[model samples]
Target: MARWEEIENEAPEFAARVRSLFEAGTNKTIATLRKDGSPRISAIEAQFEDGEITFGMMQDSLKLRDLRRDPRLAMHCPTLEPPKENPESGPGDAKLAGLAVEVPAPPDTPHVGAGFFRVDIREVALTYVGTPADHLVIESWHTETGYRRKTRA
Candidate 1:
């Protein structure tokens, strides 16, 4: 697994696109594992800074308990429809799969006893659709393989 900064260093363009989607909005969706091993989806806000991706949880939140037990997670950027005026206006939707590691909160953090976690990326992907041709495009990056892309009609 690699940090966001390492991905940026190894694959600048791919990293930039992923960063753009994360920066385009403050809200994203995350999936985590429930106690019984089922999936749980929740809305979350993440930060990409200082070479890492981090997110916080409210004190004693169920999500925090879930993360404490199982750190595996998948995050998807907000979905955006294609622009009517220009087909190329939308970059794409981004997704990331990673493990969350609990971290110490900064002294200035407002949420007392809140859980703070950093993402250790295992895979990252961008999906592009609704273009003029209506083809589906998927670009993916992995820790070992670097980057790969595919398109389908």
Candidate 2:
């Protein structure tokens, strides 16, 4: 229900951590629903700008068709192994679940007939291990609930 921008404005600190995870790597993973109602996972690059998350796909891409049909999607930020010497420095991981509202192509667009969509985030979360005690922390934001935190010692 909320766009990335709204979350940022409402919960700046939590949003920063989630956005950092997304910015930590260029390649992210997206999950889409296949025509047969099964799940398909694909590599994608997304842009978080102008208070929205957007991505484009080549013409006739399965993911594109899937989004067109189902719209629902889940995306995850790329993960890195914890540093050998400093576990505290681990950047953690982030995930977004949302609906992809396809953007209408502009007549003069350069990518020919590529597909585009703006993410309508339903849930956003970041998971990390806290310092010292090393408890697992999961911080999440939702359109209806705002923000919540959970820790497992």
Candidate 3:
């Protein structure tokens, strides 16, 4: 992770939209590699908090097992229409980060994946497209813990 001193800041409205949309329901595509170099994919429901987005699932599931070996992971939370296919394709300025800590299995649920994963959003890229021509493009960063602006300068 880079030092706090050097980071880009995101606009308030952008952050707010992310927070709101995530709350409703976004398809999270978690990509991981298998032992034989095969690809493993899982689509899951993700919830976003002030600091991180959480995913709950079974402990004995395939995804959790894959995560144990390869910590390096990439996840895409896409916002789509009711069908939940073909994401709306909004601004790419989404705060993203790699997650490490995976919570222990939940007692009642008895699910191995019934826990939360935190993403310390390092930065986001915003792409603006309109009728005439693409004009606005911005990259910003935020504090790892909460969605606080790190590029406010």
What TM-score, computed on C-alpha atoms, does each candidate reach?
Answer: 0.92, 0.93, 0.58
After superposition, the stretches of candidate 2 with alpha carbons farther than 4 Å from their true spots are: 106-108
Per-residue lDDT of 1-153 in model 1, one digit per residue for the tens? 888898899878888988889878888999999999999999999989899999998998888889999999999887777776775567789999999999999989988999999999999998877456568788899988988988888
As a whole number from 0 to 100, the lDDT of residue 12 in candidate 3 is 57
For model 2, how does the per-residue alpha-carbon lDDT over 1-153 read when each residue is reduced to its tens digit? Answer: 888999999889999988888888899999999999999999999989899999989998999999999999999998877786777678888999999998887578798769988999999988887785368888999888989999988
Candidate ranking (lDDT, best to worst)? 2, 1, 3
Off by over 4 Å in 1: 84-88, 130-132
Each candidate's lDDT (Cα)? 0.89, 0.90, 0.50
Candidate 3 accuracy as TM-score: 0.58
Give the C-alpha miss distance for residue 135 in model 2, angstroms: 2.0
RMSD of 3: 6.9
In model 1, residue pairs whose N, Cα or C atoms come closer than 3 Å (at least 3 residues apart or on different chains), thus clashing, are none
* Candidate 3 residue-wise lDDT, 14-92, digit = tens: 6555555445455767766777778787876666543455666555777767767764455555643322242234433
Regions of model 3 farther than 4 Å from truth: 1-12, 24-26, 36-39, 81-95, 112-116, 120-123, 130-138, 142-153
Task: State in Å the error of residue 136, model 2.
Answer: 0.6
Model 2: clashing residue pairs? none
Worst 10 residues of 3 by lDDT: 1-10
Instruction: Report the lDDT of model 2 for residue 87.
Output: 73
